[model samples]
Target: MKKVILFAVVLFGALIKAQDKTDSQFKYLEYDIEKIQNLYRNNKVTVKEVVEAYFKRINDIDKNGIQLNSVITTNPDAIKIADSLDHLDSKFKNKPLFGIPVLLKDNIDTHDKMPNTAGSLALKNSFPLQDSYLVKKLRDAGAVIIGKTNLSEWANFRGEKSTSGWSGLGGLTKNPYILNRNTCGSSAGSGAAISSNLGIIAIGTETNGSIVCPSSFNGIVGLKPTVGLISRQGIIPISSSQDTPGPMARTVKDIAISLGTMAGEDKNDKKTIGNTPFLHKDYTQFLTLTGLKGKRFGYVKGITKGANKKVDDLFLQTLKILEAQGATIVEIEKDWISPEISKNSFELMVSEFKDDLNDYLKSLGKNAAIKNIDELIAFNKNNKEELQYFGQEYLEISAKSNGKKDKNYKKAVTIAQKGSQQGIDSVIKKYNLDAIIAPTTAEAWKTDLKNGDNYENFYSSSSPAAIAGYPSITLPMGYINELPIGISFFAGKWEEGKLINMAYTFEQINPQRKVPQFLKE
Candidate 1:
């Protein structure tokens, strides 16, 4: 017994020493996907080395240094998968995302060991039978499925006053820019992780501000594509009308590449069937440094005014840059989007959440922790940790909803679709615009569990496009006291190409993106 104990102690000490050495070796490795691929091709590094480096980085930063808690789980088989890819034929290595490590928001399904929990304790043990449609596409493109990320429980739709990045299963994901500030949800982990260089790329879903808001706060590029562009078949549900997965990354070029890999029609999702005309297998083809020239853009000044003064000043500079590039700017009125549309959209989400969530639970098979929302609510009530910060008020409200058959629900859907679509269409027609521009969201607010989100009258440009099922892209604009802000470009349905071009041009001209300093209060 004494001899065995001595051997165990020595082995554990060796493991700790090795981990410290690995962390120090790769602490400053560059995270650009193209650069990493070139190194692999030159035989200067292997896929396994990259995977191991990322794992070491995650351990150092996410698990220990700042305790970001951004990553919910890391793939145990990532090194093995990378080794297999490294051995593939040279011709096969030419894939768009060859050996690139990618992270998925927890709501996305994967048949691997990780659970699709959506940051909820109730579904912590549930495992899906297959990968999401986009996941399969990503795998086919030779991207490595790194792991799942933390999010707001149930994608921030669970309660009225809940905190953004706090989850029962994974805890709170802190903003990498400033430790005490919030990383907005429901794509919280994806934004923070990507900003901190934990992974090369990550996939995040947005019902409204989930992707863009977090991206804005964390200083990254987030693209919420038109609803049907990426199939939502295997993802845990929110509202079927507005839920879509998007790419969140550090560069527009990287986002363009990832968008191409994930955009396609899926047999399980009927909404994607007729979207072939808008789908592009190589979206990077449209990226140009001169894309802003000769393009007419509508500036939505109302929603852009109330944010930080530094952000506002930066936005004005951005407009000047566009004008210098020979792009026309049309100023738009404040009341572009109707109040009725906002009201109806909220009502629609309430009704759809019940129907969609129940269906998703049924799809999880009989082994799910909680079968439905009612059970989920009960589980939370019994588990104090789930309700330590906020109650499941939204879940309670959704459970009481008259599933999809209500006349009000139908009316709300029609009005929401009509209002949002017309609101964007009219502006484009009036200004002969390629897209509309606005600030993506407010600056990173202080994480306040007691008082909830510090944004009392927060106005986002994401809502109109989200409601219309249109594409919108947010890129880093500038900083306010080291906290990042973002500018958004959105357009009519299936106008992803236009938005991408405009955003890429803006990125090339300004190039203001900054890495996080991990400052603590």
Candidate 2:
């Protein structure tokens, strides 16, 4: 009896110690990609253990504690894949993203059991026939697809007055900072999950503010790369002219590391072919603490005026930091994106969306839930949950459009391309500027279940970059009323390297981002 009691006590103590160790990993959640890799090198944590810990965090924080609802589905094979990575051959040991677990927005297809629902119930069981080009690249770079994230249904182009983070399938993704606040749209889960430390990195697709807005609201670093930098081969379509997947993480360093692996020409995306010259095999080489020195950045006017005055105050403080770091800040007029350009860009996207969407759905073969935009609209009408909050106005409009072959599409694309690209080009040339800096978007607004997105009263600097297909980076500047505000650096096509360098320097200097409080609001 004494021996048995002793054995039981010993086992209980060991379990308590183990629980304590796991509980102490709150700090571990803030670790960047490089730190996690370092932990792997030192054998302090195995890849399997790392993934398991994230699973715990997701269950406790995302699904249970406050129910962030950021993750739509977790990869069932993540642990098995991580274990295999732990036993990888010597040649595969040094891969850039070896053993790193990443989350993909649900819109991006994965051949694995996980479905690419794009946060819609209609295709909740739809798995891709193959991995997306970006996923293929990430997998090759030693990254593991740990799961798919919740996103704005149809990437927020589905309907009129649609809420940013609400989806028919995954529910609404709340801001990590304040549980009642929004996570912005489209890439909503990527931003929330990264900020909440659910995953080390995530991929978010953007046709406009989707990537940066979520990142800004969640207080993380997000990059919307040049349209061709990352292939859109298996992603659910939005605007073919504007859509591209980009990396989201807590630090700019991880962004650079991830970008290197994802950038390459692919036969599936012909736009990538012409941009191959701009692709860097290793982008981390461009990162430097002194990168801000001797660089000229144009600061756009009226961005801070878009919303809270506190953000404007923060922007001014950032300008002082930039000058102190040896950067020349020049005030640039906000004429780079005109109303005419915005109108034309929207027209082109409407047509391209119908055409591009049909192509992706057809690519899924006969098992696809619904075949085209027309079917999608009809599905929403029949399913009450799909229209519980908003109507599919955009899908209806796209169904009525003539598609890419339409004369209006050609005219819109031509004008949108020439006007937007040239507008940004002419300004940069005149000012001899390396990039244009502005507020990424307003601080996140309160999530509205009935009225939909409340960003109309807020400022957003995403259109110029999105329409022109330029690269842009948004990083935490500071916070306003506990919500984070982000500063953006965007410029000509293929300037991702320059943007990374500058954003990294600012990040290191300011370092304002902090883990969310999950405030009850």
Candidate 3:
């Protein structure tokens, strides 16, 4: 017994020593927004060096030290892109994200040499013919396209019992702060990679809580802009009404900058019309630490009755911070809002997912996997590893849906729009609130492949914003254990500027963002 105890103690000590060494080896792992900016300003780090550091980190931690499985494929043109950016910077450093390395969730199309596979082998070697509007914007801003990150296969829309971050092509993307914990879907890799310092920032697409949930789980900032604020063109779609790509970054400022660059009208997406006014060429102008003053936030504490005690406590602490920051807090009345509309949003998603996805697949040209909803159902049945972990119960449910024409779907949509919009718009009109505040979700629970997600109470605060075609942003408030919980601020359609100001205010007052320490037991 003494010998066994002695061996255990020695082994534990060795493990601690090794972890310290690993942590020290990566100096740029936990860089702040200003620190990286300063490094760029002073020429202490070249674009090539920064991109190379991330690549080396990916090679070491992603494939070696931790085997995070966060990335699907490294960009073949990364070095060339970096070199070209260096020359451009030498002549004129006009680009905002000049030389900064950014990762893409596999669902976002890139016309580069790298293929955009949404973590499915079904799209292997199937590169799109054109760059997404967001991709073009990133290039224009002089950002380096580093690699594609792993995601929940088909963006977590395919299955009911699906794992949040698992992809057959790229495997599971482990949370950087805690290896055993989940990185939440469907933008799991984008969140995990940013949290792990694998990239400066990443872009993620959301239909429902895809961006915000993963951001909350991974302890980062996720911006789910107004439906038409960012173009859905070239993005693998779940719902055209709900699907919009936005930035995931370690800081609100970084997220703002990326969003500003990415927001614009696209010929491919007609819905983006009249978005030019919302697209600020300089979103950084709104980032002020003192912006929290005189702001009104609608607190949805009613949703927290059944939440985790630890998460609730953290949330209360966040409320205190907001109060101290000179913001007005008002409790949401139960009668003003109900859960019925939130439930109906999912029904609308199911019907739209079928129709919207088929159109997207057809746009992908020949040699693409399953071109329509029926074909997708068949393909999932054929692929065991991809479909086995999570049965396509939702897809099957969606298959039964009659696109947009079903009377049931129409009723669901009408109820959703009326119920959610009435609840939100009435409150906003009555109180004249700048934004409504609520928890993005309860802190992420442990990942369970066998049983699926353990979602507690999340107010579905985003549903009103999503259905209303408005904007929402989730920022890390505090943590429950090592897991991060986020506070969301939402506003009505075309009110992105107001939402950004409010979110920026809260972010400045509460700078509780921290790098996760991955402690292995």
Candidate 4:
């Protein structure tokens, strides 16, 4: 009788202990960087405890509950790093991103146990020889890299009609807002993960609309910095001129904090050589309540109208708010880049991709899974899964090209740069405007495998900035049927400071960010 009573008592105590442990882990869950840091300072939590909470949340919401499928593979060394961080006094000193957890888009290389697959089965087990330049910056600033997130395979440069978030190695990543809706590539995972609070912040690479489009779809903030602002040395490329890694987070302040750490000179990448003068040591210094008070913004009447009424209506409402905030909005209809110039810029991307991808593959050394584009195309032909959804028509076209050696490559570069760069500069200078504002893109599309990426109106202004290698920011404007739409603020080169101040002001005056419920269709 006594033995039975003792067993019952012990079991009851054990259950109570487990409950307390769970509560401790969750007390600081779903917090932003500032809040998390405050919790750490108050001795309310440790870095390891916070990391464990994120892991639990990821497993519950991402892997099983709603099945977000955002994370590709988590780092084995995350907990160990957290432990090391906790051992120090003045944990926040000199570490701007001290103990913050981040998720990286799969293409960015990390030399750790985690493979930088870029969502291809051919390179599923491919580990980078060294950390990418930005990854090194993150680690140095004391941010813990938790995992690599799924991206559009080859950063969505693979197929003629490629599905955004579908990859051969890491299957489909579902939209957190509505499970069936698409998360735009190739930063799809970073955007979705940040939306679902899988990590406090995420880093995603962009060539054109990759950062802003996903951010708009997922209800987050993303910044595509001036091309030379961040290093492109270690990142897998789409176009050397257009490709840039940017930050995405729930709040504009968080991205500002991250950008400060990410920007610097990369000796290997020549674009960043003379970039020191343009770089700001602390981007958060620009955030102010009255940033947009004296600024002039340009908008086109035809761009956001007549497509989807809800998106247009929301954009119209946004304009009223900007006007009320002491800023003047100007009409600049028919001022954007022409179709022919845009087409030529695209051809340049195709030309650059072959040389860039081959260079990256060769850097992987002797034991890489796929040697070059030829091997990748051959592998795709043999593998059923790689060709299951879409045909690799883009790869075939790129493979036959002579890259920069071709007669038209230099001409294409000149036309693309001259048209895009001048297009933005002329407009900004003509009207004496601070920046250009437009709808980021149409709302999230339904994820379809048979027919890929059908859009309603498909309005986007990312190309001008992208082709020009300029800076742009996208933040949540409003939602249509529980789907988020974003508004963009873009300007000529090295205007990131002014852009951040403007975006922060807009977000502050009228914040529309909403948390995803992971609803099923």
**Tens digits of per-residue lDDT for model 1 on 90-154?**
99888999989999999999988888999988888889988888999999999998888999889
TM-score to native of every candidate shown:
0.94, 0.94, 0.92, 0.94
Best model number under lDDT:
2
TM-score of 4: 0.94
- Model 3 Cα lDDT, one tens digit per residue, 466-516: 665667899888876556778888877777666667777777767768877
Question: In order, what lDDT does every prediction score?
Answer: 0.83, 0.84, 0.76, 0.83
Candidate 4 residue lDDT tens string, 1-521: 00000000011111111011332345554578898888778888899988988888778767876678999999899999998999877845348889899999999999899998879888988988999999999999989999989988888888766778889988999888777788988798999999888899999999888898889889999999999999987888888878999999999999899999999999978889999999998999988886788789998886754666666678888999999998899988585676666677777877888999999998899988888888999999999998999988778878888886767888888888778898888888888899999888767777877776664455666788888889999999998767788999999899899989999999998999987766655
lDDT of 2 at 324: 94
lDDT by residue for model 2 (1-521), tens: 00000000001111111112333566566888889888888878889988988989888878887788999999999999999999977678689999888999999989999999989999988988998888989999999899989998988888777888889999989887877778887899999999988999999999888898899989999999999988889999888888989999999999999999999888989888877788898999878987688989897655655445666778888889999999999998866667888788888888999999999999999988899888888888899989988998778877898898777998999888788888889889999998888877666776777987753455677887788889999999987767788999988999899899989888888798887877764
Clashes of each: 0, 0, 0, 0
- TM-score, candidate 1, is 0.94
| Cα distance off (Å), candidate 2, residue 96 | 0.5
* Stretches > 4 Å off in candidate 3: 1-20, 32-34, 89-91, 455-460
Model 4 segments more than 4 A misplaced: 1-26, 91-94
Q: Model 1 Cα displacement at 45 (Å)?
A: 0.9
Which stretches of candidate 1 lie above 4 Å from their native place?
Answer: 1-30, 302-307
> What is the Cα-based lDDT of residue 330 in candidate 1?
90
Which prediction has more favorable TM-score, 1 or 3?
1
Residues forming the 10-long window of minimal summed lDDT in candidate 4:
1-10
